[model samples]
Target chain A: MGTALKEKQEKDLQHEDLLHRYRNFSARRVLFIILGVLILFVLAAFSLTLGPADVTIAEAVNTLLGMPPSGTVDRIIWNIRVPRVLTAIVAGAGLAVTGAAMQSILRNPLGSPYTLGISQSAAFGAAFAVIILGAGTTQSTASDAVIFNNPYIISISAFIFSLITTGIILLFVRYKNASPATMLLTGVALGSLFTAGYTAMQYFASDVQLASIVFWTFGDVARASLWPEVVIMTLAVLLAFAYFFYKSWDYEVMDSGDESAKSLGVDVNRLRLHGMLLSSLVTALIISFVGIIGFVGLVVPHIVRRIIGGNERYLIPSSCIVGAILLLASDTVARTIISPIVLPVGILTSFLGAPLFIFLVIKGRDFW
Target chain B: MKLEIAGMDFAYDRKLVLKNVNLKVKEGEFLTIIGPNASGKTTLLKCINNILKPKKGTIKVDGNDINHIGMDGVARKIGYVPQMSNRAFPTTVFDTVLMGRRPHGNWKPSDSDYRLVSEYMEKLDLQDIALREIGELSGGQRQKVMIARALVQEPDILLLDEPTSSLDLKHQLEVMEMVDKQTENGLTVVMTMHDLNLALRFSEKIIMLRQGKIFAYGGAEVLDPVNIEKVFGVKVSMAHGSCGPVIVPESCVI
Candidate 1:
């Protein structure tokens, strides 16, 4: 009896020892996250000075610090350049983090923001709005809505359609088989379906409506922001990131497969559904504003995973910073490379992203 | 810490997998459930762990019906390691094991979670490869990593399905030894094993399952030639080995 009592006491002490062990995490991970933040700020600052109006870093900072505007330079920096940069950063981050979550939720590496027809649906909505509203109304509503020509109507239309598109996917999740493959296939079918609808709508668009539709599809950050309008998405994506970060460990457990995760006490179905809705919402918000920027959502998550491990707590923020910096850099190049002839940032991303991704894959050699 | 099941029925898409199954597993008991393919061994384990909801049944841990306590609560008491997981994409071994602490935490891992994970990793001889991706590890190493992840749950009962199915002979024995050690402590283990000999050797109790029902269950005595023939439709003779009972299959008489 005495021996058994002592043995049990020793076991309890061992359990107590585990609880008492002081906790500290790796310093290297912290350094990388801090480094990513610094790189984003540096890249954004460098990008701000590189556009058609060559505002120097000092001028940009002075204009930012609320000093008296140096006439056109201040106006250009504050109005055109600043909003464009902020929009690019927020939209890029939203796309990448949401893409990461979507891939995990679907349990498919190929899953992305565009996977569920979100971009096509948003485009269809924008085009549909242009065809209907422009023919019916005068030119006054166009400028009033558009950033330059017809902005607000197209965005609002895109936003509404994108939500509807995500709604379709969620409906499939609830009623039909909610498997990852089913979702991916459904997304592909929806993408084709929406593209066909947009093409049909385009046939009836007038000259002015057609041009606006074409411009929206080019996916430029220049068209998105005026002043504080971009704040909505920035705040929304931040809230989404915080929510996912709070449940980051659950995502990690989910990587082992649904059954294993369920046995670990995770509600696998609910979390996957939650993740899909959230990812769709994030993508829809960006697509409505930025017009279907491709590859950032799909590419940035993998790049972040390559640098950092597959932990969402770090991966989500890191992907955000990396996506922002890369898109900002891409946007900077798109505007500056031809001096006055600005290229769409979307074209530049594919041009730069593919070769670099191929190089990483080849150099990775043993990591498969 | 004891697992008890009564009048359990399970079906996938209304195709019954396990029917009218009743079982009781004691604390610190090593119970090996053996059955042929689709015979419902895996389903039984899943039902106990709440991975699958029974059609009509009461599964209790320490006399508490598991359905009432909820899955997260069941998770604190039961940990399950799947038979195969090649579908899982790459993540570091440490991160993979740390995921077991999810039931106990939501945001960040507690100090105790880390310490328990470290201890299990050390016990499983996985400290050397903790930073390596699970995809990079060999089959045997990955199995150990999975077991380490299951152990971090600090579960009173551990359930495994075909854990050593793909492992080599030496690796299989090594993996079994690690699981057997869990029973020496206060943890109860219920595992579905492919090798009848491994089951007979390691398990204190063996349950023979056939057609979604308990054909027979108990100690090594219940695992005799006649019962084995009835359950598996094979001719087998049992002999005393240096360690435990050894089963030799003479013919597939079915």
Candidate 2:
């Protein structure tokens, strides 16, 4: 009789220990994601309505749905505003997700495409195409105005050079089995090397060539065409996001440390290599097309992390939506804030993101 | 599971860390390794779990060579808890403990996984801080969290490196008692220790290492004053406490 009572007590204890649900998956995170998507929708709609020639949201939606208020409104909405908004959404989402993945794989908070020197390498490639390959020619209208003879040549060159940097880093990881710190150090060294190469190209270029180089360096979303470029960016960003979300659990295991991660059956080396390769490819694709947008990649993931905590399942998707929100919002303000004299969205993002990142570091709760 | 290490040698760039080491641990035995600094205690533990490749020789679990077993298979049999360090990313306590279920399932934890994690968290008194970031927890709390993580893996052999370091007296007793209870339930535990008294009190068997070699290996009687002086270059005495025999360091060996 005593043993039967003891067994019943033991069963009761086990039942008491079972939780209703894991705390990591909370209502707050899902609500935050839904709210983020809503904000992105509003931002995209609002942005389409802003610009030099105003179009109301109804007209924008009408044009987007294949009926137009007028031909000129169709041109403005289809040719100008649609591509710009779509580019911002895809480019912003891609870069921010890549940044989060890079930070996790490299195990460094400062890890991003910009910090890892992929952007500098692309800039060097663009300069090489402009000055050496004669991809840009001066337009007859103005002394400083240069037009691209073939924009594809410049983009292909930039993409190739960025891959070269990625190749060198991967070789180190494969052969030397370099640690994350060592890999990040190699990136810093390569960044400086490419920066020097860019300066050297600028020193010998003609005035028109130099102007073209500077123009290509400014990150502008309108440079892309509507048909293939935006479509390709969308495909790549979705693939990358899906891959990251699928691997979210492995990334969470990795947050403990490499040794602990390995002990838990994660192939740390393989994951690091694949993560770096995919992130670098996505960053190169965006930079080669839109030039170099700064700070969005580095800052959006951090903001989401602060709000929802660092479970990657929620963090990856939230960063994608929030990234679109940040970049689209920045582009809207850039174009509308100065009237007809539109500033490059890169400049505006830096101006805003730098102070916001600083505020987070100084005043927010300690995330790391 | 029984663990057998035979003729193992490990070196780092021509400097030997573990040399010609061989030992055996029976199933359900609690074995503690006590050694001084740089004595290869951690290295031997790592080799048993295949974290480090040995220069020569084999480590077998349940008579099957662990080297032949794939990482997933090895992880199923052996759960390793590394020494505690501050994590850079902010992960919640529940998630960290839940990660032990990785080898058993995919990215999404099943209902059983959550239930197991909850059980161990409750056992370790970690349910109150389930949502707190791991970085914010005190050292003792973090150690318990790590131990809880290993427990949820449900491995037959558990390897720990300095599991009680930096903990207070009460915490140290609590951690040791938790592990002791598991060993009573047919879990094989191997850990490294700096405190000889705790090792003597709880370790069913003990291995004392010196200069990358096993100086002594036997039951708890191996933790004598002379062996302590020889291994650590410290003179010591034995005293009895409420728990069991306790080693007291008297002075450094001249």
Candidate 3:
């Protein structure tokens, strides 16, 4: 009896310790999210002042805080930098949240808008607009920017083709009863087909058309105008984010497996369909305006997952913050790396994201 | 919950998986389904949990048809732990177990949900590794996590598929004893297992299935050499062990 009492006391103490540690882990996740938001704020401020206009961080912040536009500095801060940074933040958050959702719904760590061919389809659509419909032309300006004949046509066509690819994949999932792995493979196959179409379009293009198509393929957040494009993306991204956040528990249950998720009262097929449609819609919207910013969707969620584990309540929000930070920082570097000759932020993200992803895979094999 | 299945049939495409299965389990009864490979033990459990829709059947819980209860209603009554697989993500053990409260609550878990999860984690001896990733645990630890997840659901009926398949002797005994205690509290347990001895020790009622059909169903005496040979195609003799009676496989009946 004495031994039993002693054993019970020991077990109670152990339980207390376990509870403390669990709380600490939860606290740590919250801390990471807080820190991420702070970093995003600081980075956004720094990014606003780092362009060719020589505006200081204070000046940019002042302009953002309702300072009257008195000179070139205020105009550049309000017009160019604000729209670009806001676009990056919204677009980045959308890609990351959708990436996290895609991974959960598909039960594949490699699942993302980019990996599932939404970006490629968008690219194909843009190519069709530029090469076939003559929607873009190369303006022989000092900046060598490709001016769209009707930018809305390019964006609309890109959006349409992306939906078409998503439609084909959903059809396969519905009729063929395709598994997540099978769906990914289908995405890869369709991605290749679309790439072939894009290449064929390029082969038959005029020099100006080819230049315009190539330039449009280079994803740049600065391409978005503030009036409708940025406003539309912001609303779409926030709506999708809210939906994903609300369905956070369901996504966490889905990580267990489809059969297990069903047993837990999740309608696995419906969630998958909804998740894919919303994620693809948001991806198409972002890509249509800013072109194919590849790696934010794929890599940011993974980095956040490694830190916070696979709990979607924390993972989704953390991925959003980290996604915003990564894209914003990449955009800043793309514009400032060789001043007056801004590289495409999409090219820079892939350049940075590829190596970082490889390193994470090598170093954290147990993360998945 | 009292469960009744009548005229149950399940098929994958044209290939039949379960054929005209019928069963009635009383509330708080400890039932074990024993069978060979492809014997539909797992399928029957899935059907009961409403994870798979049967081609033709009516499953009732407390005389109410499960089909009419809706998925969430069924999940509130039945908790399932599937067979352990290699597919795992980096979810913490505590968070994984807390997911069992999904049907009971809304989006966020309530405080009582956390309390229940903590209680089950302590009972399962998983509190020590509560913060560890599920993927990082050994097979036995992962199995315990799975069991704890199911137990935290607070369901009237618990379904387990090969719960002890990966556990060692000590863990096997511990899990069985824990589950046996739950049965005393009026939790109905329906488990499919390959281990005949463990089933005999803990199961008050035994179901022997062979090729998608019930070969035998009764008390411990029903698991005799004749029934075992017919269902499992193995010749076995019941012998006394230090703890209880054990089935010693003598030779292959084929």
Candidate 1 wrongly placed segments (more than 4 Å): A1-26, A68-74, A135-148, A204-208, A365-367
Predicted complexes: DockQ each? 0.49, 0.64, 0.64
Candidate 1 structure quality by residue, lDDT tens digits, B152-208: 989999999999998999999999998999898989999998899988888999999
Greater TM-score among 1 and 3 belongs to 3
The residue ranges of model 3 lying beyond 4 angstroms of the native Cα positions read A1-16, A69-72, A355-368, B86-88
lDDT of 2 by residue, A1-368 (tens): 99999987885565454453444356778999999999998889888999778799999988889999999999998887888899999999999999999999888888888678899999999999998899976673342234677788899899898988888998999999998898898888998999999999999999888988888888877666475899989998998999999999988888778888878888888899998899899999999998889888888889878778888888899989988887888888887886676667788877877777788778775776
The DockQ leader among the candidates is 2
lDDT per model vs. reference: 0.82, 0.87, 0.86
Question: Which pairs clash inside model 3?
Answer: none
Q: Which DockQ-derived CAPRI band holds candidate 2?
A: medium
Using TM-score as the measure, the top candidate is: 3
For the candidates in turn, chain A alone yields TM-scores of: 0.86, 0.91, 0.93
